[model samples]
Target chain A: MSTHTEDTKDIWLDECFAAARQDTTAAPDDLITKILADAGTMQQEFATQSLVATPVRAGLFARVSQALGGWPSITGLATASLAGVWIGMSAPAGLEGVTQALVGAEAVIDVVDQYYQAEFELAGDL
Target chain B: MASIEELSDDALLVMYANGDRDAARVLTLRLTPRVFNHALRLLGDRAEAEDVAQEAMLRLWRIAPDWQQDQAKVTTWLYRVVANLCTDRLRKARPVALDAVEEPVDEASGPVEKMQDRIRAQALQRALSDLPERQRQVVVLRNIEGLSNPEIAEIMEISVEAVESLNARGRRRLAASLSDKREELGYVDAH
Candidate 1:
C-alpha cells in the first residue's frame, strides 16, 4: 500500500478503536448483585469449613486444657510458676536460710557440682 | 491496615478466601465491570455478555482459595477466564451474518461529535463480531482493552508472534469492512 493510504487506514482504525474503548456498558446492577452473592456464599462455605476443622486440629490442647479444669486453672498454674521463679531468684528475709536448712548448703553445692561435672564429661565425650 | 481499596487484587482475593467480607465486596465491585465490558466486546450481546461475566466471576470466586500469585496476576487470570467463557458461548451460538446486522438506531440528537463517535463505535462492534473468534479476541484485547501484547498472549494462551499476526489480520479486516463507512463515520479528510 502507498504510505498515504496506510496512514489513512491507520488513522481511521485508531478512531474506531478510540470510539469502542469509550463505548463501555456498565455491568447491570442485577449481575453485580448476583456476583456479590456468589462471593458471600463462597466465603461462608470457607468460614464454615474452617470453623469445623479448627477444633479437630486443636483436640489435644483442648483436651489437656479441659482436664486441667479449663483456662482459669491454667492461668493459676502459670501464675504459680512465675511466683516460684521469683522466690528462687530473691527469697524473703525470713525464708533466706530455708534452702540451707532443708537441703543443706554443702549438699546443694555438691549436687550442683555433680550436675556441672556430668555435663562437662558429656561435652568432652562429644 | 490498608483499606481494601488500596489492596491489590491478589491481596484482596487472598483476604476474600480467608473470610474477609469487605474484600469480597471490593473484588466484586472492582472486577465485575471490567469482566462485563470485555465479554460485551467479544460477544456483542449484552445479555450473553452478562451471563459470561457472571460465570467468569463465579469461577474467580471459586478459584480464589487456590490462586497462585507467583504464577499469574489476578487480572491476567480473569482475562483468560472471560476469553474462554466468551469463546465457549460463541462456539455454541449460531453464526451471525454480518451484513444482516441492522444499523444502530439514529443517535443524532446528541452533540455532533458524540453522535459521530457512537456511530463509529457501533460500526466497529459490528465489524468485530464478524471476525473469526481468535482474531476478534486478539484485536479487542490489544486495541479496545489496551492490554499489552504479552498480556494478550498470556490471556489467549498463544505466543506473542501469534498475537501480533492475529492483530494485524484483524485490523486489516476491520479497515476493509469499515472503508465504505469512513465518510459516514466523520473521517471526511482523515482529520
Candidate 2:
C-alpha cells in the first residue's frame, strides 16, 4: 500500500479506537454494593482489632508523655535533664575558680576596710 | 479534614485503610468503571468482568494498609490486577463467543450514526479478541485507554521499548484483521 493509504488505514484504526473508547460498561450496582460490604466488614474487623489492641487506661507517665507530644518531647526532656546532671557533675575548673574569686573579693574588701579603720584610729591617737 | 473527593487515590486508599467508609465509597465510584471496562474488554464477558472488577477492588481494599505511596498509580495497579485475572480466566476457559458480547448504545449520536459506531466498536472488539494476549493488552491500553507507552510498560511490567514494539505489532495485526471491513466501516471512500 502507498504511504497515503497507510495513513488512511491508521486514521481508520484510530477512529475505531475512539468509538470503542465510548464504552458504557460499568460495575453494576450489585457489584458496588458487594464490594462496599466487603470493605465495611474489613473496617469492622480493623475497629475490633484496634479496640482490643489498645489498653483501656494508659499509665500516668504514658498519658503525660502523650500529652507532651509523645516520645519526642519525652526524649528532649530526658536529654536536657542528662545535660544538667553532666554540667553539675563535671563542673569546669574555670567555673569553680570564678566562684572562688567572687567569694575572695568579698573577704578582701572586708580586710581592707578593717585596715583603713585601724590606720584612722592610729592617726587620731598620734 | 479534606473530604474524600478532594483526596488523590493514594490518599483515599490511606483513608480507607483507616476505616473511613466514605473513602471506600469514593474510591469505588472512581475506580470501578475503569476496572470493569478493562476486564470486559479483556474477557469479553460482562459477568466475568464484574467478577474481575470486584475481585480487583477487594484486593485493593485488603492491601490498602500496605499500599506504599509513590510506588505506583492506583489505576495502573488495578489494571495489572484485572489483566492478570482475565489472563488466568482466559487460560482456564474457552474463548468468549464474540456474538455474546453486546454493542454499547450511544445516545449522543443519531440512530444511524450510533448504530454505525456500535458496529465498528463491536468489530474492533472481535478483532482484538483474536490478537495474542499481550498484544491485546498493549493495544487496548495504548489506544482505547489512552495510556502512554511508559505507563503501559509499568502496568504490563515491561520496558518502554517492549511496550512500543508490542503496540506496533498489535496495531499491525489489528489493521490486517480489520482491512476487510474498511469499506463497511465507511473509512475507504472518506479519504
Candidate 3:
C-alpha cells in the first residue's frame, strides 16, 4: 500500500514536469512598431486637446445672480432657500439618531405615570 | 544588480503621465512583448494577441498618473490586464476551429523527430484548450509564463491555497489528457 502511494506521487510529479516545458510564438516585429506609432499619434492628439480646456471665468452679474439664485433684492429669501436645501438633505440622519433619544424619554414618562397610578391606589387604601 | 541607466517603472509612468512621448516608447519597449506573448498563449491566436497587447499597453499609458508606486511593477499589471482582455476577446470571438501547428524551421532536427514534435505540440494545445478557464490561466502562469504561486494568486485575485489547488488540479487534468502520448511526450524518465 505504501509503495502504491509513492508510485502515484512519482507519476503525478512527472506529469507536472512534462507540462512545465514552454514554447513561445511572438507577434511580428512590424506590428509592434505600428502599435508604438499609433500610441504616439494618440499622445499628440491628447496633448492638443488638453491645452484648449481653460476654466471659464464667471462674469460679475452672473456671479451675483448665482449667489442669490437669480434674485436682485430678495437675497435674504435666497439665503433661506439655500438653508432649506441644505437642511432637507442633512436632516434625516440627525432625526433618526434623535428618534432613539425620544424613545428613552417616552419610556421614562411611562414609568412616571405608572408610579403615580401606584401611589393613587395606595392613597385610596389610606 | 539594478542599473542606474534604466528609469524605474514608476518614474517612466510619471513621465508617460505627463505627456512624455519618449516615456511611452520606453514603456512599450519594456511591456509589449511579454504582454503579447501572454495574450497569445491564453487565446492561441496571433491577431487577437496583438490586439489585446496593444489595448493593454494603451490602458497602461492612460492609467500611469493615478498608479500607486508601491504596487506591483507596471509590467505585471499590464500582464493581468492583457489576460483579462484576451479572455474578453475569446468570449466575443466567433468560435473558429483550432489552427493546425506549423512545422518548426529548425535545421538540425531530423524529419521524424520534427513530425513527432509537431504532433505533440498539437496534442498539448488541444489538451490545454480542454482545461477550464481558471485552471488554464493557472497552468499558463505557472508553466508557461513561469510566475510564482504568490504572483499567480495576486493576478488571479485568489488565496495562495486556491492557487495551489488550481495548479494541482489543472496539471493532473493536463497529464491525464496527454496520457495517450506518454511515450511520445518523452516522459521516459519523468517518473
Identify the candidate with maximal DockQ.
1
Give the per-residue lDDT of model 1 (tens digit) for A54-120: 8654588888999999999999999999999998898897785886788786774454587789999
Off by over 4 Å in 1: A1-9, A58-126, B97-109
TM-score of each: 0.72, 0.72, 0.64
Please give the CA lDDT of all the candidate structures: 0.84, 0.85, 0.69
Candidate 1 CAPRI-style tier = acceptable
Give the CAPRI rating of model 3: incorrect
Off by over 4 Å in 3: A1-22, A53-126, B1-5, B94-123, B189-191
lDDT of 1 by residue, B1-191 (tens): 87779999999999989888899889988999899888888888778888998899999999988888899989899999999989998999987666544333343466877777888988999999989999999988888888888999999889999998898899899889988888998878864
Task: Name the candidate, 2 or 3, with the larger lDDT value.
Answer: 2
Model 3: per-residue Cα lDDT over B1-191, one tens digit each = 74422988788888777788777777777677778767766776667777888888778766765788998877668767876887787678765465642222334456675555545655666676678778878877876676777888888888998988888788778777877666666656654
Task: Evaluate every candidate with DockQ and list the scores.
Answer: 0.28, 0.26, 0.11
Give me the runs in candidate 2 sitting further than 4 Å from their true place: A1-9, A53-126, B1-3, B105-111
Q: List the pairs of residues colliding in candidate 2.
A: none
lDDT of 2 by residue, B39-120 (tens): 8888888888889999999899888888999899999999999889999998998867778875554557667766777878
